[model samples]
Target: MGTAILSGIISSQGSGSGTQEIDLLPTRFIACVRRPESEDAIRSKLPREAPDSTVSVYVKDNCAAAREADVILLACQPHLYKPLLLESGICTALKGKPIISVLAGVTSNEITHQLCQTAKTESKGVYDTDAFSVIRAMPNIASAVQASSTVLEIHPRPQLKGVIATAHAIFSCVGTVFTTKPGNFAACTTLNGSTPAFFAMVIDGLVDGAVALGLSHTEATQMAAATMRGTADLIMSGKSTLDLRYEVACPGGATIQGLQVLEEARTRAVWMRAMAAATSGQSSLKEGLKMSRGGF
Candidate 1:
């Protein structure tokens, strides 16, 4: 997910005049990771046009990277947050920065608490608990293709104004950005994070059906994908799902006949269940750290 967002940002349109918001787009990206080999691994996967000067990789040095960045995006695993924050000079480097986190189920308040914890733990007693303005975001895998549905938790505090704009500016590179209350973010994560996999499953099933009807796999795959894209576009353009479905499933048409099969199978109900299950899973995830506790 972190790599995908990087790819999208690297693919961003070049610098623009003050008239366009592109001027606010990131000019540099610094990714900090624990392993030395991971640096090359990340660089290898990015867009070919991404220059070494534009993107820097920090090997086990979060403070150095955070110090150089204007806005800090926390993309590391949730469990790693504790150790990452505990790094020497971490809080000091993050001071006054707009911190955006992509950690699923983790709240900005929780992140603030972690930063405060680190401030107290630093060997040098110069502590800075008010280190950042937090923006919690969830950007999906489609960010690699610049079509992600990103969910950003919106806070209306005056102190967070700059970070709010920064969040929009940064996330807009990937795709649409949706703002929701902190309370709604967990539910919204289903749409931003889980639905892509669900939609892919639907596409897979559709393609298989087409293949079963004797269409070549390649042909079926392309057709299904294109159709899905067009349908999504229609919906985005304000066509209601029921209206769109009805338009295609004309009276006594083959579309309606096929719909009957799916309708009888309770496909819609299954999808609702899937959504509930995903939301439930996210709630559990946000409840607390559950991943590996191993340090960086």
Candidate 2:
């Protein structure tokens, strides 16, 4: 995700000024990794062949490197995040800096408390202000190629303003950015994080249908993919998806015949059920965690 964000920021130079101007300059990126092996792997992946921009990579344990950063990203998995940040002493180092978290199922208030405890332990003094500002964001895999649909929630410190511009510039390079309430992050995760999988399944089903009609697997897949892409483009170009579907369903035509088959099978209801099941499972996990915590 960090690599994706970096790529988007660097590529935004060609995307014109309005939102792109806020992304970090290529030279400003300071990537830090916790493991030595991961550092070597990342360095190997750098575009040494023909590069327009460069990134400075640092290999160190988290907190130590975090001290020098004005904006720190916490990108580890949720279960490991609190313990790792607390143990690394990064929170103590964040004095008045911003800490952006991409960990799923972890709330800003929880992060604030953990950081406050860490800071208190390190300083042994009562601090009157929040030591760090946190922003929780949910960005999908498309970010790797600068085509993500990112959802962000700002939980700014009392003294901070104008941070949204910075975030917008950074995320806009990859795709669209939508401001959402912190409580909605989990729903955003289900909607955005799980969408690609849902789309892929639809594509696969289309390909299967094509293959059943005697097309080769490769041919079917290509045809299905192109059809799906074109449909998406049409929807994005101002036509509602339902409107497009209705347009294709000519009265008693081949398209309508196929639609009848799908309707009889309750295809739409099946997909709705699938999404509800996935969302319910995730919500249940959240509730279980809260119970374990004796209340979140």
Top candidate when judged by TM-score against the true structure = 1
Candidate 2, residues 1-296, lDDT tens digits: the string is 56555555555544443264643422355677666776556555443431433555677666666776667666655666566657756766776776666666777777777777777777786654456677777777676556788888855444444455556666776777888877777778767666778888988888888888899999898888788879878987999978898999988899989989999999989878876775655544333353321111
Q: lDDT tens digits, residues 1-296, model 1?
A: 78888888777644221114565667888988888998888998898878898889999888999998988989887666767887888888998999999987678988888887777767546444445688799889888878888988988788887888888888888788889999988788787888988988998999898899999989998999999999999999999999998898999999999999999999999999998888877545544546542111
**Which residue segments of model 1 deviate by more than 4 Å?**
14-19, 123-130, 284-296
Judge candidate 1 at residue 220 and give its lDDT: 92
| TM-score, predicted candidate 2 vs. hidden true structure | 0.82
- Candidate 1 residue-wise lDDT at 245: 88
Per-candidate total of colliding backbone pairs: 0, 0
**Candidate that scores best on lDDT:** 1
Structural similarity to truth (TM-score) of each candidate: 0.91, 0.82
In order, the Cα lDDT scores of the candidates are 0.81, 0.67
Q: Roughly what TM-score does model 1 have, to 2 decimal places?
A: 0.91
Error of 2 at 191 (Å): 1.4
lDDT of 2: 0.67
